[model samples]
Target: MRNQLPSSLHNGMMNYLSDLEWKQVLDSLQQGLCCCGANKYADWLHTPWIHVDFLRENSHTVLRYMRVDGRALPPVLPSSCCNPFSPTPCLHDPLQQQRSLSVWRDTPQTAIDTVFDKGCLDLILQPMVELLTAIPIVNGCCIALQLISGILLRYIYTSARNSVLVGDPGGKAYGWIFGRGDCRFALGSSLLDIDKKRAAKQKPSGNSGQESKEIGPRRHE
Candidate 1:
């Protein structure tokens, strides 16, 4: 499926990340967020799967930290982990501790920090923006293709109608050309309308662009 994409699309996907920018993104992921709340950790862990899938579908390499029981481990021990609310501390068997220690020692701190700090949230945003931006472009392409198909169908029907008018004594020379053409036009027009509505929905409001521009220069200072 990836190989079938046009080179321009491939380049567009590539433009979303460079080696350096990607490293920064990865670095950001490695930084651990202070474990303040379970809800925060949950949001950090689960919300980015949607973004990761989006990037993977778009041919971007997605980096993820290892998981245990489907949950991502934090870089440093969170307060919750360090001092549990429960009266008794969760006990790991000696074998479990040995294995955990070995794994912890082997893992790179940077990678752990990236995963623990950011989870997949930052990584997810870049692909999400690209995905949002592509919607209008895709809608336009669909509209264009449908319009072309309708035009061709109309032309073919017109030619057949003309031939029937010239040669056939019976008015029925073109059996159902007009009906078929009308159906094609109706289908095409309906689809175009739907796409136009979608494109409108996908478009960013003027205020958003203005806000971005307004914020851009201040960031450098």
Candidate 2:
């Protein structure tokens, strides 16, 4: 089926909805509409025509939760119930069975009143609104990071190209370093040469004086 989104939402707004937001929406939808005191399997099977009408009226929203393929969902059933009066002893669809199992497994002794409260649209909207509010911040950060990355990459490429062309007047040293060795080695070698010169300059003048004194004593002898 061709998935339809609201035209009111812009492409930029959609980017703010992460997988987490979609999951939350799905979870809220699965909660289903409030049974409104309809507890028994038979009660659910014989749900008021008005309630069904209400569901039909809001099918755009309700169908998303009920049916995967936009077809009518299988009837809800009790966990361990049988109707001997009916022709089919166990009229359970695999999908309905799985749903019933999950409901029972989660809350074995769920209260009748709490079993159904309200539709999940209210719950679903809470997260949606929060996500919408954060769009500006999230979008701004993403744009800023992209801009910074582009600028950094351009600067690096320009610097590398310039170093190979102009840094070494002969170009041979830069060409060798850029082609055969990495820029890191080129930069490290320069730092290493500076350190070697500093170490040579730091050699003790006292040591040279000591050598001269020993030579003078030997000459006097």
Candidate 3:
């Protein structure tokens, strides 16, 4: 459960992992990837992946590759881009796509990216080069861009849901990494404004016995 995360994680991370969440994270990570050969390993588990590293252009990006080896694969990038580290991450991207892992496994699996897919970038080289030249105009912009990009990806694919915790064990106040969460980022500015207004209104010299009237919901008849 989400509320139980702190104590449960504190108790131990693997300890409280539920069947659904476990299956989801594992499914998401190894979704498009399958193993073959003597020793089996999860597919694309390694990051700074070849397509990300070797692709010359967007079109040539490994995500666009038709096959990993001789076998076809799925377009399994996160739907929105946000730090997956962010719990309750928000933001959305329309580009995110989902793929059935079962389909890819029926065919053989492929792991050789640098060796086989090297020439793919040539197709988009010119425009990509032109775009790279313009990068100097933006400095350290990639960090913010990736953060937003990752957040935008959140909407594209189905992710494992955090457990719905009613309360923390023994009723202690639960710890949360809420500072980086979407709810904070989205409403923090407005909340700060409300805090300031409340502080000002509590002053001894402030207006008294004033009540605000409630407005009916827009949809209410």
Candidate 4:
């Protein structure tokens, strides 16, 4: 807080804390009406200006306290945002989709072991899903065929986007109108899993020394 004064003030934001101010406020809150939550120890991770030593010391104690006191903390989650709540681009080709995310799920000792687990949801999935809901209305040719046509058109769009239709001229790539060029790296199922696996390997593990040789574009290992 002390070191961050200039940027916060220049940005037209009031500083949220100072040492003496926080100490006083914390004293008051200990006696206040608001309940913090079940994971009171983990909750401090949300606070600013927490000390390293305190976190190192009291953090474990707090988690233990919460556990013993029967307090429950929210579980951390990985989100792709598209689910059965969405059944578009994803459910399009079930077999291909798993090759990206669940690559390892099917690995056998004889098979090249491969599995992908993309962590964060990619930016591409949402817009593609929305495009799915829009097509039936966009063509609007006939009331009877509209619903069925929209679903089929959505399938065509996804196939064009993922596999590159390859027949266009005038210097446009296949599926150029579908915007795969813009969002190609933005993420899709199998590719996202590859990204996730790479990211996980980059984290510093107990074997920090060996970590140097461990990450970057991977291959069958």
What TM-score do all the candidates reach, one by one?
Answer: 0.27, 0.28, 0.14, 0.15
Candidate 3 lDDT, 1-221, residue by residue in tens = 33453233223212212344633443342222221110122222221122333233344333455354522233332221123333432222112312323323452232121011212123224466667787865645877897777765553221211111322233322222332234546634342354356557666553332322234335556
lDDT of 4 by residue, 59-156 (tens): 54334323333442212111211232232232211123434323223432111111111211122234656787898776675665876777677666
RMSD of each: 28.1, 15.7, 29.0, 35.8
| TM-score of predicted structure 3 | 0.14
lDDT of 3: 0.32
Candidates ranked, most accurate by TM-score first: 2, 1, 4, 3
Point out where model 3 deviates above 4 Å: 1-22, 25-64, 68-70, 78-81, 84-221
**Best-to-worst ranking by lDDT:** 2, 1, 4, 3
- For candidate 3, the per-residue lDDT at 100 reads 29
Give one digit per residue, the lDDT tens place, for model 1 in 187-217. 3333235345656887989899889888786
| Candidate 4 local Cα displacement, residue 19, angstroms | 1.1
In model 2, how many backbone clashes occur?
A: 0
What do the candidate models score in CA lDDT, each in turn?
0.40, 0.40, 0.32, 0.34
